[model samples]
Target: MNDIVPLFGFTTTPLELVSFVLSVITVALNIRQTHWAWLFSILASGLYALVFAQSRLYGDAGLQLVFIAVSVWGWYQWLRGGTAHGELQISRLSGAGWAKSALMWLAGFGILSIFLKSYTDTDVPYMDGFLTAGSLLGQLLLSRKKLENWHVWILVDILYVSLYMYKHLMLTAILYALFVIMAAMGLRAWNNSAAVPAAVAGS
Candidate 1:
């Protein structure tokens, strides 16, 4: 749809460009370990919900709404989550932490995919659920300042790129491509940030 200039259906629409701009800022804030990232992500997702709905990507559209809720929780978590610190700091997830994350993602993916396949006319149920569940975990991890969140984002972003292409949303596809690269950069930034102690920084 991005390749064409139609009256609707991503043709002449500026949503993709808007989404890209918001996503870029979101990734940048994420790289700085700023809780503000979730704010931008939420706004981007709100726009994406409309785009996906127009494209009949029902599950993906619904997922964007979930992102809105997750962003709120993530924002609250980042602001005053740990004790009386008043700010959270980047950190690594422990072994059990990774395990719990894995289990939740797997279970959510399986159940959500099955439900979507049965309830909606979506073709790639697994892909939708996979991206959704991974994003949920990544967002939660990011909310807690866990560096491993980037890994989840990288994986989902790659898959999402292909999915957008499959839907003929070239702009969305390109945006996900950028997301993958930014996730990689965020990994480096967050990892380096983890090396410093939260008690010392002027966050």
Candidate 2:
């Protein structure tokens, strides 16, 4: 799977191509609020772990492992993490919730960056850590059916495009670019979905 092959006039490994496809499917299912998205996320993250490790992106490689574990928890959350332990509902973050998320992102970035820098030879430890932290926050928010998860994803995906390009992973870079657009769509869709409850309660 590591063998490089020409694709669309560029080059990528079969593993990357497969990862790219699975990730796209995962995001699409997520936008629809489908619980099955987590399964695809697990598969994609596992494959991408290998892809990132080969490039020596230690932070990202480790992150993919975390993603796999998180995806499992996320799957259960989507099914039962709501009022009265019923199906989860789409909801916005409170002001305090947003503050907590920001703090968590900063803390995770600081810790992961220091660890990666001290223990790994990856050339872009800081960037890797920053994005890895953001991705984790985004995934957590997503698992809880928080509306702001899409916002987190949009920022992370935009930055990831540049990072992947720097690492010469052109296909994965393109995937992140597509993720930016899809994240925006998800934000809008979830916003509308969230409003329905409010509108109904008001009515």
Candidate 3:
């Protein structure tokens, strides 16, 4: 097994490297309920957008554009969507939330897989669609301040790490490994917020 980082794809370039690094920090801080996550997301998604396009992962690439729009919206939600006391408190997804997100993921993957298999000559079409569709679900959940988003990310990131490894994108694989850690930390941090509520705990 090779251990060295592969210098292939968009992640190997300088801006992508910085963008990738910033993405990790942004995600980590976001889980900790910090507002800097959006900044890193804006940087990282811009680079990944190119990466996915080059790899013919059009669905994933397109998702990054949506991410850009959502990031701005998320930034605003994080800043002003809190209760009167302030601080973005984490919460679990409601039943409707689960139903809707699950339906969306299923529908997206089914449709995109058929489209890619028919119109595109890409390998691993199912995996591509699965990751892309699942990411949309995860990102939306995160934007809604749902703690379960971290759980979805944990599952998705695990799959991503393996997929990137197989594609020889070692750096991105490692980044996903870090995301797994960050997601765990996020779960704990959000649970803490739930116990005492970050906005009211100090006072």
Backbone clashes, candidate 2: 0
- If scored against the real structure, what TM-score would every candidate get? 0.89, 0.96, 0.86
Query: Which model, 1 or 3, shows the larger lDDT?
Result: 1
* Candidate 3 structure quality by residue, lDDT tens digits, 57-149: 777777889898888877877777778735556788889988888899899899878877888877778988888889888887787688888
Q: What would the per-residue lDDT of candidate 2 be over residues 62-130, giving only the tens digit for each residue?
A: 999999999999999989887787788898899999999999999999999999999999999899999
Which has the better TM-score: candidate 2, or candidate 3? 2
- Scored against the true structure, residue 103 in model 1 reaches a CA lDDT of 99
Worst 10 residues of 3 by lDDT: 1-10
Those runs of model 2 whose alpha carbons end farther than 4 Å from true positions after fitting are 198-203
Identify the candidate with maximal TM-score: 2
lDDT of 1 by residue, 177-202 (tens): 99899999999887877787766665
Task: Rank candidates by TM-score, best first.
Answer: 2, 1, 3
Any idea what lDDT model 3 has? 0.79
Candidate number of the best lDDT: 2
lDDT of 2: 0.95
